[model samples]
Target: MSSSIWSSLPFVAIWSVGYWAVHVPHLLFLSLRNTIKPLRPVPQWSYRLSMGTAVLRAVFRYIGALRYQQPLQLTPGRSGDRFVRIAPPADANLFRGVFGAPSAMAKPAPVSAVWSPAPVVAPSSSHPSDGRRRKVVIYAAGGAFVTGFDPEMSSRFTSALVTSEHFGATNLLFVQYRLATRADPFPGGVLDLFTAYQHVLGLGVAPADIVLIGDSAGGNLVLALLRRRAGLLALGRNNSRSGGQDRALAHQPVRHHGRAGSVLGVDAYRPKGKALTQEEEGYISPMDHPFRLETPLYIEAGGAEGLLESIVTFAGQMADVKGNRVQFHITEDMPHDFFVAYPFIGAKKESCEALKRAKLFLEG
Candidate 1:
């Protein structure tokens, strides 16, 4: 071998070791988590190919954390572009427990940043009621339910959504949800999502008019929320079909923390299931909760993501159910969270195509 090739052997060896160091544990952890067969089986080749993208994402995330370290902090007393709108008090309990440190680290309140287009108002037709024309997008960040929200990341995504042709200049709420670990567990993140959804509804935006967009874990939350919504709607429909007696019973008023659970009936989406595995994870399957309704859902996934299997299966499940206006796109060769990184990276063609599809979905 050449002298240079021999000299570079140490570097190559170290790189290979580091690559496996990062990937092996992650893949193994996923394996352990899926001892009870995942909703969709992830093939071996797919896992191997996705590791490259995962490594790239990790490198970018670590570098970006150091670069945009200040904006990533959720400290208090900050105003202007740095501040976040807090969540309501009713949902504050969702962050309690052992893994609550992440939530408490923030301003002792649930908060999120809002983005709206500047210098232009969306068309009047966008808003369904009150003659005030506006479009609302409630977005959640994806970090495998372990990493908390990043301000800079949310800002980039919200910007892409707002500037898109289909969504012109619109109102966007970037929700910050609690992350789960072994200490925290599941459903806490899902509960935070429910709170965020309710917060958006409280902001006077109709549920039908609001669009839910999330990526990866955030996408999972969107699916879960849609499932819950579907369940509630189906329950309501079934009740109505069964002689309208239930609607009268629902009106009889049951108190929940001092307010009726629902004016009409029980909202199945209100986080009833106590166990995380049964309530949240179980409903993630589209076969169980295919969001078969008129809600306009736009889901974008990278063709090269580790989560692609589950995302594709969930999307396919929804597709198979019929009655859903769902626009699903897999940006070929892209990795997870490509939308946020597109500006920093130079995959303008693929990224732009994904965003274009998003715009078309919204416009349609």
Candidate 2:
């Protein structure tokens, strides 16, 4: 009886191992398929593979199956190219936190080439302020810490603004920043942005005269600067023709002013709380900063972005503040970074309208 039991134990163990081996991949595949079902007309095979990887990553994420709590290391390839070793962070909720770890600790291999500054559109000699026909405007493009900053991505708005009937002859200083990846983390790009802002500020333009315009991530930075008084937030209260007042009201939902209003007022319109701890929220959030409301600011974001909560929250906070002057343009049905896809299906007529509104808000 003892011998039979021993033999049976081994057989059962083997069978169990085999059963899991056979089912695990299928389970992972099914989970991936179900997750991506909403994203159909499921492209070609390569696209499917990429999407499948993204989906599987999300699956591993939802169940908390990952072993590592932070991003994996990257290593240099044969040709001095950097390659990430572990799978990219899954697009799960925890993915951002995991990927948000400092790049120094993560030890991603360095790329040989450094990102050079985008060609600075020099202020034309013909600026009206300088008795010339040109105006110098700063353009900050937005991405949710991950993607974008390509020339094509910025061209739609920049080209139009530089050549528009309203904003024509305006020279653009397009500020391009780094992105968060397995290599780069949060605040890496944001720091670069401040450097760019300071560089522009050093160019002798008064903070009040500089028209700062940014969308999405760039918008967040603009508001951050405004909140920090790194520049200003031009409130549209002065001009009847300006759209800033309307946008500010629409961006923030009004609540009764009360005892809680001080804590939860316009300052709450920023994207700092909820998912973040009090300390983390305080450190990274623009709302936590002080402001002077010096420059005319134009900020916009898509209605469908997850960050809309923070955007509206920060906007509300700004609105509640006694002297902060900020304006917001919330475009409907627009997803995060929708402007990057200009001339694509997502760039609806409303984008044009938003640009027009932005131009008027800035030029007014």
For this target, which candidate reaches the highest TM-score against the unseen true structure?
Answer: 1
Q: How many backbone clashes does candidate 2 have?
A: 16
Please, what are the lDDT tens digits per residue for candidate 1 over residues 177-240? 6554333344455555666666655555555456666655566666655555555555453332
Tell me model 1's lDDT, rounded to 2 decimals. Answer: 0.49
Question: Where does model 2 exceed 4 Å of error?
Answer: 1-134, 166-169, 181-186, 201-209, 228-283, 287-292, 346-348
Candidate with best lDDT = 1
Q: What lDDT score is found at residue 191 in candidate 2?
A: 44
Per-model TM-score on C-alpha atoms: 0.58, 0.48
- Which ranges in model 1 have alpha carbons more than 4 Å from their true place? 1-55, 58-82, 89-111, 114-132, 235-279, 284-291, 307-309
